[model samples]
Target: MTVKSKKYHISGERLEELQQIAEENMFMHASQLNDWRGKLNIFVKGEGVWVEDAKGKKYLDSLGGLWYKAAGYGRKEIADAVYNQMTQIESSPSGSATISQIELAGKIANLYPEKSSRSFFVSGGAEAVETAVKMAKKFSILNGKPGAYKVLSRRYSYHGGTAMAVSLGGAKTADPMGPTMPGAIHVTNWNSYRLPYSGDPVDVAIKCANEFEEVIKHQGPDTVAAIIAEPVSAAFGIQIPPQEYWQRLREIADKYDVLLIADEVITGFGRLGEYFGPMNWGVQPDITTVAKALTSGYAPLGAAIATKKVADAFTGGPEETFTHLITFGGHPSACAAALANLEIFEKEDLVGNSKKMGNYLFEKLLELKKYDIVGDVRGGLGLLAAVEFVADKKEKVAFPASAKLAQKLPKFLFDRNIVTFRAGDIISICPPLSITKNEIDYLVDAIEDSIIHLKKDLNT
Candidate 1:
């Protein structure tokens, strides 16, 4: 399977056109528009775990294109699937369903924690989350609890960029220009690296889980529609909560008759070595939001799968109709792409490989903690892992924002032709699930070299 090995560079007038038209005029996501307005890396090619810039320089994609692309890059099967579906039906009307949509929805429902489930599709992670919250509230209304509209999520969780999703993000990312949607509340989550409450890691996890119950009571249980959280919180860091924490959440939701929503935007589709993350916790959330790796970024797609108990409430009569609709939701081409991606997951055993390589990566990351700049390593499931930097390893004190350690470290890695995502002082090491052992070796070795140089530069 030979890919286009020839070097690709935009050196002539085309480069000028791209820069003048796209780079200068268009803004990037989650980036400072003014600061990076003209200076941007233009990637035009990808193969396996590597991507090539317009300059034809290749770099290891350590974060898998924002934690999607689970099947790696340049998958012809996925491309063919999308193309074939486009020829058949590019899209169906919002009120209508297509063959690909029906098949993919059925696939998702079975892959969810609840076998007897239904899937509602959307275009992105944020939209998927928004759909879940709306469904929760509507289900509450049908279930005779109209006041159950408030959504409770964890602090530092990144649901998405939409209004309701931003509110669920808590103080970390709520939009300042707008008021957070009414009734969206965020509670403390378990960050073992830096315990918000006073206790050991496992104990802190349980306490943090209990805080949801406390907050629900404080906010009035009847007013709280659902408790939404990630099975493994990844915005701040890859913080995997203990089973005790998950158990408590299940208990709390049941006790209060509140719905549980698992935001699997990052953890789903073999990222955590599980086909489904919430199921790995032995808990069945009433609603689970999924995106990112859903179609491996081959196309825009997301879905919220609801358990039968919750889905049954929508009798489709009178006020039971789901009024909201996304124009591109369940587009047949996107569904086709997802179907092909999942086939790759099973055929190549990428999920199994994720666990295998994930273990190997964790072992290597543990070795990195010997360095003063490497404060903590977090990960145990799949290809998800994070390394936190600290000025004082003994005290676990993160470098102040003024240090700009996060900003500087990536530049060092870019020089070494490696790309990984970072959140403040924490570096995320999630690559494509199809990543090889040799690739992991290269990634960790570069990470080590970068750290050694960063430490020396900081000292002076």
Candidate 2:
């Protein structure tokens, strides 16, 4: 089979359009544009984990387009699948029936810990979370707890940007958008290293679970429908909860009749070395929402996977139906892309690679404790980890957000041909699972250099 080799040089007319588009569209992106010093650098292409700007500068792409792009840029397999699917059937509403939608849902549902869990498709993480929130509320209302609409989530935890998702999020940046959905409550997250509570990690996890009960009691469990959390908090520092956290939380949720929703947008599809994040913690959520790695960002796709019990609540002999629908949910092209992407994951054993390489990255980062600015490193197997910077290690005091160290670190590494994500003061690394040990070493070395330069710049 002979494949056509297409040149990617930009024509004069297209170049002008690109420039015009940037200028005319500049105001619409005013917020991000302002942060970019009045000009946006347009990117032309990507391959593997690298992206090239219009100016021809290549970046290692650690941020991975806000932690999407799992299989990395230009995976011909995914691209081919998407192209073929689009040519055949671009899209249609999954309106109560669609063949591709059903098959894709089955594929996703099997990925869950529960064999009988049902799946609902969505466009992205925020939508998946939003759907879960709606499901939880509607289920509670229909299940004899009309007052159970409140949700409890951890502080600094980020579920998404949608109204209800934002409400469930604990991240400071996520809030202040406006008055959020009412009844969403905030609580402390699992950060044992930062909050030195004496005892076993499992014990600490149990304590955290107890805190949920306390909060529910204070607010009246009758009013709380669900408690949502990232199994391993991703955006607000990859804080891995103690071993017993999920188990205890599960028990508590069962006891209180409150649903547990695991927001696995970041931890799903091998980011955590497991097929799913909740499995790592040995607990299953009543509902699990995931995005990011779903189609490896090849196509916009996300999922709301629910236990059989939850699905049964809405699936009563066709008399009662769940009043929810997304126009592009389970879009044929996206579903085909997702199906292809999962095949790649299976063939490559990406999950296994993530576990092996994640351990390597974690152990390597622990060696950076010699640097005073390196307050702590947190994360779990494969592709997910964060290196937090601080002014005083003993005090665990983070650098002022204004210092821009987190933002600056990535740029410094970009200069040296490496890239990373900076979430506030923590330099986050969720490299594509395809990353090799050599690449991991390269990434770490660049990070180390950035730390040294930052320290010098700060001190001077």
Candidate 3:
């Protein structure tokens, strides 16, 4: 809690030099085709829950550095851990495992729902998801159903950017990329805010869940490998499902002999106050994909933690060795950083803090309902949250795409010196689990100011 971001400012000449590099050398991701390269806000340093831009201006990092940073920033322990690991051994081949990888795998397994689960490391979340889907298909093959390679995913949920991950997640990011991966079936995703049908909340939830069973039946369960989804969808408004929903999915998966995968990349490592997000509802998935907080952004790392049942499928015969491989799947330095980051979590009891603060945050968010632009505020899990904007709250109508309501609101918040990102019509508010109430207040206040200004802009 005492950690503070160090002041950082580049000289005018240095700043201009960096701007030139941005305009030419650096190709940004999901950006305006290098149109505004020099206009980028270059963040130079970070510590605790704050980040400093090149101009020496510090802002509270409200999105937890892309929903990781469970232990926050500028931890010397993490840096030292990585340094020591690199000096000892920097990398490992996919076929082989390093001491760090072996140790880290055990530590990761202990945190999973089934403590005896096995971990298969990857570079990050996208790869983790890609790996999970493949694991399910492989399991299907083990069950003598090589034809069962199809995966079922919720329409609005986000998995990652790889072909398989994109295929599993039908979020907006997958739209412009053209066709989804073959055999990926997108199904109905439920949102409590805007029900697709009118009925009792519990009954309606069951109806939505039944839609998946229907998909499995229609697609032929024999041809289906797995049903995949984020325990709580992040990019699509933090869509939280009811207990009944997960229960139904589990039951259907069991009845149909289909594997269940929980894409826990954004919700893992105590993001939802629970060690694993799905634990909130007592749903133990066959495979859990994770990343982001695995190394808390200090090092790129991810893993598919498979339950003993799923892992045992690959343990037979010389040919059954789970043939999937990533060249740099379990880098030693990354494993070391992940181990250290997790140590910080235990030392600080960040998970307990998340539960306490998450409750307080949701209670406070109710106040945003007073504003016309605030249509829905959704989050019950730890730090993950979203505020969906609407032009007509009563009717739950969204601001037109032409208005770019989601885009401009974050810009206004930038002016107020807060850092966050918008996912379509909603703005994410996932700060570090280490965040204090005062920091949350600062973020919410900036959001309020941004909303007020945005309303004015729309009216004008």
Candidate 4:
């Protein structure tokens, strides 16, 4: 369980060159720190749970390439699958009637809870969200509720980065952009730590469901078309709702006749110890959008799976077309990659691993709460968890935005050879489900050491 620092054998000059390349050419995400540019350690290779930087520094990949490398890095089978598919039918687009695309679509459709649901493939998560919104609206119209165009999303949940997805996202950071898509209504999310209601777990769940009903009634249910939610609330620190939330939410959606869209972009395909997050919560969605682990990020592929009821509403003669299409919607190579990825998940018993490892990680993280700087440690029984840092232990005071403490904490770990990041004030650990217990111990040690070091420096 111990991780000794390996010899970083590269010359200092070579390390400087890599740092300069990132500074000069890379366009970082909005969450990335500009000052940390020079501190960036360029990765050169990966195998299993370890990534080696250009400097030959080996780090445990706890973030798993934005939570996509579910099967772990340097998986030879994945590479072979992609290579074989590329050699066979590399360039067929969704626009054409191709066999690879057709077969892959069938494979994806089969993954849905409702076997009758159809799938519309796309390049990535954002595109999937965009397609889901479009489908929800179109389905609403076809069902004779043309005015129902609003999408209700939960606050602090992240959908994706596309305009429509960003609009659908209810996070604080997502709003700075002047104008997002209209009619994207947001309701309070079910994080008990932030909920206004003070009661038992079942009471809180009921209250949250009531809040959704209030939002619907206030907005007029006739005007609302769908309610999109991340079943496990993956982005906002992986907020796991209480037991009855899903059932109650489903009740609310059905009562209002609103299409329930589960955005499983981050929680599907073994991330939540289930095939889909919606299924994990025991609720059925009218439409489901998935990405991330769909192809384990080996290829860019996403799907919007529509339930039979939703599909049947549009199942007329040939004249009733979807009228929606992405040029590379069902790209042959992407489909091949996804099919292979699913096969790997099934063979590896990864879902079982996620459940066991998630429980182990959670138990370990609970020990972290003893540290004064760690305000909260939370997650579920899967390969997802987060530790939130705070300025004051007793008051739970968040570090000021000007200080940007959350960003600094992860960078500190990164510099110390642990790859991870944060969502808002919470630093998350969503390593590939294939990570071993020994790797988990290394990740925990890295964070533990970094926090002690950072706290000492801040006090001084």
Q: Using lDDT, give the best candidate's number.
A: 1
lDDT of each: 0.85, 0.80, 0.85, 0.80
Q: How high is the lDDT of residue 345 in model 1?
A: 88
Tens digit of per-residue lDDT, candidate 2, span 62-114: 66677777777878988898888778767764345545567778877777789
TM-score of each: 0.96, 0.91, 0.95, 0.91
Q: Model 3: how large is the Cα RMSD against the reference?
A: 2.4
The worst-scoring run of ten residues by lDDT in candidate 4 lies at: 1-10
Q: What is candidate 1's lDDT per residue for 23-96, written digit by digit as tens?
A: 65786777666645555678888999999877678899989999898999999999999999989878876567
Candidate 2 least-lDDT 10 residues: 1-10
Candidate 1: stretches off by over 4 Å: 1-8, 171-174
Candidate 3: worst-modelled 10 consecutive residues by lDDT: 1-10
Higher-ranked by lDDT: 1 or 4: 1
lDDT, residue 4, model 4: 45
Candidate 3 or 2, higher lDDT: 3
